[model samples]
Target: MHNGKPVVLVVEDSPIIRMGAVDLVLLAGYEALEARDADEAIRILESRADIDLVFTDVQMPGTMDGLKLSHYIRDRWPPVKLIVASGNAILEESSLPAGSRFFPKPYNDHSILDAMARMLAS
Candidate 1:
């Protein structure tokens, strides 16, 4: 946690979507960190131990996509929660890291916030 608030890393290749996710995270009372792609997100994750959760988009221009990133995080930072989103890809439940949640594009802000709250609470 950062400054007594949960720290969430929002990873999206699209600037607009990243900004919107950051806004939602901040509005939900978490400290928001932004990354344009999986590589950047990995750098941040490596440097920060206070991050409580990751909110990432599936499609990205990077060495690894969000699915791979999620798997990496699960293996390396097991304590962190994950919320993965994708507009086009149809992900299977088994494809996600254990305990991670998935949401399609145009996900509800309220629902995301609620999920974050529940994940953080647990």
Candidate 2:
């Protein structure tokens, strides 16, 4: 956590989407960090321990996509929460890491915020 607020790292290859996600994070009263792809997201995760959550895009131009990244995080950092999104694919809940959440692209902002709040509270 940062300054008593949850720290959220948003990973998206699209600048506009990333910015919107970051804004949503800030709007929800969390500190926001950003990465363009899973690789960068992993780097940030490696460099920080205070991050409470990760918000990631599925399809990205990196060695690993958000799905892989989510599983990796679940394995390497079990305490970190995860939210995965995609415009191109819809995944089954069992496909994601246990305890992680997923949303299709064009997700509802309120729903995202609500999910974040609940996840962090837990």
Candidate 3:
């Protein structure tokens, strides 16, 4: 096994979106897991305990949205890197916490993979 490769967790309400994200991550030579929403994301994160990064959407139809999900992850896994992905202006218009990243929708796969590489590197 590759010891230094990142472990990615993708959280998107839409199955299509989640699957697409996971495919990209896998293609990039990283390990990946998926969740339909924040709840599922939390469950997976809690269980795996080795996730290095999370890619979440800001807008979701669920009890916990992406912003709240990011906060929850930050609180629980302070060392885990977080990446916010969405087409929502509200999330992008505001500032993000230190060490976190945001990528607006319609993001290029190469760009996202590059960013993930950088995040995991740190």
* Predictions in order: lDDT: 0.95, 0.96, 0.84
Q: Residue by residue across 1-122, what tens digits does model 1's lDDT show?
A: 87899999999999999999999999998899999999999999999999999999999997999999999999999999999999999799899999999999989998999999999999
| Residues 16-111, model 3: lDDT tens digits | 888899999999988988888898898898888779989999888778888888888888889988888888654643456557888888778888
- Sort the candidates on TM-score, descending order: 2, 1, 3
Encode model 2's per-residue lDDT on 55-100: one tens digit a residue.
9999999799999999999999999999999999999999999999
Please state every model's RMSD to the true fold in angstroms. 0.6, 0.5, 1.9
| Clashing residue pairs found in predicted model 2 | none
Per-prediction backbone clash count: 0, 0, 0
Model 1 TM-score relative to the real fold? 0.98
